[model samples]
Target chain A: MDIVLGQLFTGLSIGSILLLVALGLAIIYGSMGVINLAHGEFVMLGAYSTWLLQSAFGLPFLACLVLVFFMVAFAGWVVERGVVRFLYYRPLDTILATWGIGIILQQAVRLSAGAELRYVQTPEALAGSIDLLGIAIPSYRLFILAVTAGLLLLTWFLVQHTEFGMKLRAVTQNREMASCYGINSSRVFSLTFAFGSGLAGLAGALVAPIKSVAPDMGTNFVVDAFMVVVVGGVGSLLGTVASSGILGGSTAGLAFLLNDTLAKALVFLAVVVLIRFRPRGLFVDRVRR
Target chain B: MSRIKSPSHAWPPANSSAPPAAARPSLPQRASYVQILVYLAFCLLILAVPLVIDDAFLLNKYARYLALGLAAAALSLSWGYSGILNLGQGVSFGLGAYAIAMHLKLKTSPVHTGAAGLPDFMVWNNVQTLPWFWEPFHSTLFAILAGMLLPVIVASLLGWFMFRARIVGVYVAIITLAMLVVTNLLFIDQQRYTGGFNGLTDLAWLEIGGVEFDPYSPTFYYLTAGCLSVCLLLGLALTRSKAGLILRAIRNDVDRVRFFGYDVAAYQILAFAVSAGMAGVAGMLYAMVLEFASPTFMGVPLSLSMVIWAAVGGRGSLLGATIGAILVNFMQGSLSETFLDTWQLILGALFILVVLFLPNGLASLIDMAGERLGRAPPRARTEEPAAAAPRAMGTFNTKQRG
Candidate 1:
């Protein structure tokens, strides 16, 4: 019973991390229809930002999180304006272009940061673990969960009830109609892209303490995030949430049963099989043309 | 169609005059003449390299470049002609490498093998006998056949699933990328069977009919060059075929092609499988060239590099992509020696520039120059308009269509 509860806690922690990383991908791909391959680079930049702040400037982890969000968001905005804007009409070309951008960003990070792993110290307040139902859950894991939940709600509200969300949805559905109604579709795309990148950055900052922060760390994260978005359904927030949980829980459970590597392979196989059945993903939005 | 009359022609006085079909045929014939001249020139250049360069080391290096060029040409067949961006091409390449490497590894002397003739890594992992999968690889013929067939089977299955579900464009790229990660992990994790990260090294030279093909020997170079030429010619023939025309049509507007009663998925699967087979052949040759197989062959960098090679050469043209792979790789080999850390940065920047300003790549530049020199109106080539306006994958609601 204790083992089961402990595994469940581990599963939730894993699920929260997946959701955090995938949220931005889901938004950008769903709204703009641009497959931002450099998104992982945004996450990498966020981690590097956190490390620089905590080590160089002696800033607190919480403060770094807030600042890293905007910094990475600005970087994403520049990428969109500079390169991605031109390739919007040629969506397939965007994949190759963004991959080039990802390569550039990764190399740039490697050159600037000296190709070594950078570590961030966890907050002193959240260093301890708390006993809950015979399972000792780390306070940092709990903090990540809280942050993910808060961000999920924030993203939900922003996309559902806010004017920006309305503009984004309108642009997604019918760009000409949205433009006719005085909604600047390009600006909306730019902002949504920035926000999505910021979320990825936050994810990077949050995971910095737990995972080794390196220039190439984003590759694996990006793949996982892609899987989450793909399985969750492209643009559906609820789908993203549910799929992350399903993937994370299965990963944890499978790892416990077999091994870590096999668990990953099994999860990938499962996702591929699932996609074979549900091409649009689990929670597809029924939007009429 | 507007016809430009010659300055000698009295056009206003000839109401019953028919259009000059004889002149029309000559224009295209002249274009093909130029194309044949270029093709023969390329073939001659490849064949003459051994005579020009006496250095065994340089010949070996050039041979590897040719192998990579073959892979790029294979990529062009699917990506350029069929419009499928397979980011996980390295998976097929690596699998083919491993298949041949296993055979060569088994043929090595007892120094590298433990008691009972098990591979050293397997001995270290406490395996007394050879695994079942490794058994068939002992036969050189079986290994070579498997090297090509394995990737074809895997790619066919993957393409079948993807196209059946109607997954197109960027989604195909993403799924392939994901598969690369999975395959890489699997290869690395199965340390006991796969020799882990160190991969299969210390391979014996492949021998056939009393002749041994050493990596640094001229014979091996010729073998690689011969295979590459065959693959390129095959690829060129494929692109010029009727099915290839249909594939290009599918790339432009899949829905329209479907409406015309074409089984779009079947064509996609065919191009994908053929591409994978070519990559597999390249992989087999690469393994022979390098004398080992490592997991890094399936790495993201190598796979992406293959794409860059195709794009830079002209993904729309098979021969162009082949030349591009060779040129880029040759330049990379020399430039990295000087610039080291900055080489990737330069490559990335170049890739972006090509994708943005020169979408058809360096080949199109040559084509443009040829058209200018010929003083003929640009012919309606298959790749030009396809590159200009690519159809979005089926699922997305692209604004271009509406």
Candidate 2:
């Protein structure tokens, strides 16, 4: 029973991280229909930002997180304006272009930061584990969960209860109609792209302490995030959350049963099989036209 | 050239009152005379490499480049002509390499294999007997056949699942990329069977008809060159065939072709399988040249590099993709040697520039030059419809629930 509880806790921690990385991907892909391959790079940038801040400026982890979000968001905005804007009309080309951007970002990081792996210091406050009903969960894991939940709520509020959210929905549904009503669809897309990118950066910042920080580290994270988005169903926030939990839980469970590598391969096989059955994912958006 | 027919006929006439086939003007062939001449010239240039470059080391390096070029051409067949961008092409290439590497590993002398005659890694892992899967690879013929066939089988299965589900465009790319990651992990994890990260090294020279094809020999170079030429020619013929026309038509508008009662999935799977076979062959040749099959062969960077080759050379042109792969790889080799760390940065930037400005690749530039010289007719560029992008976006927003 203790083992089950521990595994469940581990699964939840994993799910939260998955959700953090995938939230931005889900938004950008759902809204703009642009497969931002460089999203992982943005996450990498966030991690690097956290490391740079802590080492260079001696900033706290929390402070680094706040600044990293905006800094990475700005980078995303530049990418959108500079390259992704032109390829919006060619959705497939956007994949290749964004991938190119990702390569550039990774190489740039490698050159600037040196190729060695960098580490971030976890906060003193969140260093130890907290016991809950005989289960000991790391405080950092709890912190990540809290941050993910808060961001989810924030994102939900932004999308559901704001004028920007309303404009975004209008633009997403019918660009011409939204434009007719004087909603600058392009600006909405740009902001959404930037916001989505910022979310990825935040995820990166949160993940820095747990995972090794390297230039190419984003590749695996991005792939995992993509699987979450794909399995969750594109454009559905509830679906993203649900799917991340399911995938995360299954990964934990499978890893427990088999070895880690086999577990990963099995999860991938499961996703592919699931995709075969449910092409649009587990949650279908009935509202989609 | 006379065998070339207008693929436009595969689609119904835009207007109900369109003229009969005979009454219509003769459509331009897929490749003009000048393009064919250029292809021949390119072939001649490759064949003459051994004569010009007497250095065995340089010759071996060129052989590897040509093998990569073949893989790029294979990619062009599916991505360029059929519009199925397989990002996991390296999976097939790696599989092919492993197949041949296994055979060579078995053939190696007892020095590498020890007394057990098992692969060095297996021995190291304390694996007493050869695994069942490794048994058939002992036959040179079986290895060569499996090198080509394994990727075909894998690709066909993957393509069947994907195309049958009506997964197109970027989704296919994502799925394939995911598969590449999965396959790479599997290959790396199964260190007992596979060589783990070190991969299969210390391979014996390929022996055919009692003739040893050493990596540095002119004979091996010719073998690689010969296989590449065959693949390119086969790819060219396929793109010019009736099915190829249907595949292109499907690429342009899948719904329209499906509406016309075509088996869209079948065509996609066929092209995908064939392309995988070519990539597999390329992988085998690559392993033969490099003398090892590492998990890195299936890495994302290598897979993406192949795409870049196709895109830079012109995915629309098989020969162009081959040239692109060769040129890019040669340049990468030289540039990395000269500038060291900055080659990847330059490659990434170049890839972005090509995708943005030269959508049709450097081959289109050649076409433009041909047009200017009055050597080729003005052909309508095979540009992706601008409406398709917005439509894809619109569908994502309002995708009908199944």
Candidate 3:
């Protein structure tokens, strides 16, 4: 029973991280209709940025998170203006271009930082473990869960309540209609892209302490993020959350029972089955052709 | 009816009135002449390079590139001709390599194994008896057959499900990528059977029918070159066949072809199987060239690199895809020596640039050059003759239809 609780908690934490990473992908894909393969690289960039800030400038972890978000967001904005803007309608070409961008980002980081893994110091306050009903859980893991929830709520509020979010949503729904109403669709696209990238950056920054920061680290996270976004269904935050929870909980539970490698294979197999059954995913939105 | 008929309703003015039979272009004849000349030159160069280049190492490297080129051409077959972008092409290649590598490992009979007639890694992993899977590989003929057949079988199975369900485009790419990841992980985890991360090594010279083929010798180079030539010719023949035409039509519009009562799924599966077979053969040669098989061969990066090769060479043309793989890999090799860090950066940028500006690739440039040199100034190189250029794939077709 204790083991089950521990596994459940671990699953929740893992799900939280997945949600954070996949949020940006869902948004970018939802609005821009661009499957950004380079989204993972943005996450890597965020992690690296946080590491640099914390190590070089001796900045607090929280301060680094804010800066990393802006920094990664700016990078995302540049990529959008330069490359992604041209291939909005060409879904296949956009995939290739973004994949190219991802390779460049990864290689650039490798060249600049060297191939060696780098570590980020976890905050001293969250270094210890907390006992809950006979289950010992790391405080940092709990903190990550809290941060992820807060960010999700914040994103929800922004999308639901803010005027800019309303404009972005309108543009995503129908560009011509939005433009007819005097909304600058291109600007909204760029801003939304930037915001999505910023969210990915925050996820990366938060994960840096748990996972070693490296140029190729994003490859692992990106696949998981894709699985989350894909299984959850595109264009729906609630679906993304639900799917991530299910996938994460199951994966953690499976890993506890089996080895890590076997658990991963099983998860992938499950995803394949899910995709086979629901090609459009769990919460597909109706659209006019 | 005759009384009601106006002068405008009479037979339309002869559209072909001015054209003389002698003056009119025989498009296929002219294009074939150029194609033949180009192929002859390529064949000649492949034969001549080893003789001209004093460095045996360079010759070996070139030979390896040709093997890789075969894999790229396979990608061209599936992606260019069939409009199926298989991102996990390396899975087939890796399977082929491992099959051959396993046999070679057994034949070499390297020392350090406690159990006689068993691979050193297996012995090290404390396997008391030979695994059932490795039994057939003891025979050289069986090993070679397995190398080619295994990947084809896997590809056909994968294609069966994917195409039958009408899963196309990015979904196919994602699924293939996932397969590659899974396969790589499996290869790494099964240490007892697969040699784990260290991979198969200490291979001896490949021998067939009492004849030994050494990796350093010119014979080995010729063997790979011969294999590549056969693959290219096969690819060319397939592209000219009736099935190829239908495949192209399907790529253009599956519904249209299906409406005509064609089994779209079967053709797709066939193309996929053939592509996998080509990749398998390439892998077999690759193992020979490198003298080992590693799990890295099944990696995502390698699979993507194959796509880049096909793209750069010109996915629209088979010969171009092969050449593209060779040229890009050669550039990578040479550039890495000079600018170690910047090579990948340059490659990434090149990939983006190619996708953005030169979607047709370096092959299209060659096509344009050849067209300019044609006796009759080519009819707008972009508007290639339908019979002369088999460039029918995906989104571009919609424009032609319009």
The collision pairs in model 3 are none
True contacts kept of each: 0.35, 0.41, 0.29
Per-residue C-alpha lDDT of model 3 across residues A91-116, encoded as one tens digit per residue: 56677788889999998999888789
Candidate 1: Cα lDDT at B83: 84
Q: State the TM-score of the second chain for every model.
A: 0.88, 0.88, 0.87
- Order by DockQ, highest first: 2, 1, 3
C-alpha TM-scores of all predictions: 0.92, 0.93, 0.92
Cα misplacement distance, residue A231 of candidate 1 (Å): 0.9
DockQ of each: 0.35, 0.47, 0.28
For model 2, the stretches where C-alpha displacement exceeds 4 angstroms are B1-33, B336-338, B378-402
Candidate 1: the clashing residue pairs are none
A190-280 per-residue lDDT for model 2 (tens digits): 9999999999999999999999999999888888998898899877899999999998999999889987887887888788777767767
Worst 10-residue lDDT window for candidate 3 chain A reads: A280-289
Better of 1 and 2 by TM-score: 2
How many clashes (backbone atoms < 3 Å, residues ≥3 apart in a chain or on different chains) does model 3 have?
0
lDDT of 1 at A253: 99
Query: Who is ahead in DockQ, 1 or 3?
Result: 1
Q: Sort by TM-score, best first: what order?
A: 2, 1, 3
